[model samples]
Target: MSLTPSSSTAPAAADPLTPLLTELESALGSVQAALSQRDALALERHAASVQRLMTDALREGRERGRGGDLTPALRQRLAAAGAQVAAQRAALGRATAALDRAIDVLMPPEPLGLYGQSGRTLRQRSSGDVASA
Candidate 1:
């Protein structure tokens, strides 16, 4: 195997871990991009978004009936994968919720105006003119 570096993409002149960190940051950015508008913990993917992706996969596998001899093993793998997916989904929820809460705290709602006060209708500032909400 040739050890020569590829010429198309040059490496940055920084610590080795720097590139790793940058890659991680980019990955995090991508994950953040996947987040829903109202939630930082929740991801919205249309292609194949599922809390139990493996369960769905296993279901599909069984529907297809592709294998006969490996059924037991397949079921076992499916169960294990389902468990892991469940754990990961729960973890993902917690992490995303925490991120949402952090963001909420960091970007609290702007102070409410007179209309912002709960149950109060909007009125002209000095009551000299008619106002609308």
Candidate 2:
């Protein structure tokens, strides 16, 4: 609705959607960035337009009290939109992971390694490490 995320976020305003909306923004940005590079497109660009539209429509539906067709119609549309949102987010995640792996494959290992622990090859230990700690 508002171009600015929030009034006080002078730098980073808040969206009415709040945290979930914020996370959604972050996820979308990642997808966009990943698409910006590479010779061929391997990712999808999805906007939160559907969710925003449904949210706005739902708000309007609430204005009309009991026995309103708007509510049911909104519900049906929202159900479909929700499914799309889930699928898009899942695909974006997969694409992002694939991009990361691709980047790792493309970038040669630095002498000091990524985070500077040269001898210690970064590897994931078992879940036991968490419990042990």
Candidate 3:
């Protein structure tokens, strides 16, 4: 009797990097959410996770390439995810800059020195002395 298993009975091989890509996508989504909510803690946590996942994904991709298994679709997905992450980062930077400007306007910087070089206290003058009115 034959002992070979049929194709229907054999399990399909899974792509090693698919899970990592999915995880990276999830982390990116979390980062976006954290940014929108202005939650620094969550943003930091998710950003770190995304970095780790990206490193792992790159390693896996290289391995797959060596094995001649890397697909174009996978590459496209990775590129798209990277673009999204970059966009989110830019948006966060702009928002932080705007916030800093607003804070600066609300609370101006203090003067470094209160006295002038002539041994006189520097003060804002209400009127200036001039020859003509």
Candidate 4:
């Protein structure tokens, strides 16, 4: 065999976490977009995707003998994603509270004495006499 170096370019080995991180970032972006648009169906789908990705990541970590310990890059990405989710949750909570306040103002609840124990509003009877004595 000749000892001369070959001129052909060889592909480098890829980091196993690269694809998982990429897909996770994509799913996170989709989730954020769905939240912004208030699309429940899209949100559900993307959220499931995110959950699946997380499960896969956990499995990968275990398989790699890391026992749930991730590389710095993976940890950073996950932390950012977690912060994004938390911010989204806070925004949603604020919006829901605002809507609840508006609804309360528009449709005030009955007073304590107005509603029966069973929770239905008691109907007021007419003052007019219904029958002669």
Model 2 Cα lDDT, one tens digit per residue, 27-53:
445445554553123333335443555
- Once fitted onto the true fold, the runs of candidate 4 whose alpha carbons sit more than 4 angstroms away are 1-16, 58-70, 120-133
Task: Report lDDT per candidate.
Answer: 0.46, 0.48, 0.75, 0.66
From the highest TM-score down, the ranking of the candidates is 3, 4, 2, 1
Tens-place lDDT per residue, model 1, 1-133, is 2335543233334223233333433433444455434444444442134433433455554664564433464456445555644655676689767866775576455457633755233222322232432
Number of colliding residue pairs in each model = 1, 4, 0, 0
Candidate 2 segments whose C-alpha is farther than 4 A from its true place: 1-48, 61-73, 113-133
Best by lDDT: 3
Residue-level lDDT tens digits of model 4 in 1-133: 2333332212112446558767877988898898889898998899899889867765665565465435677667666766766776787689778866775576565566766543433222311223520
- The reply for model 1, stretches above 4 Å from the true place, is 1-56, 64-70, 114-133
Q: Compute each candidate's TM-score over C-alphas.
A: 0.39, 0.42, 0.70, 0.60
Alpha carbon lDDT at 5, candidate 4:
33
TM-score of candidate 1 on Cα atoms, chains taken together: 0.39
Show pairs that collide, candidate 2: 5-13, 5-14, 6-13, 6-14
- Report the Cα lDDT for candidate 2: 0.48
Candidates, ranked, lDDT: 3, 4, 2, 1
Better by lDDT, candidate 3 or 2: 3
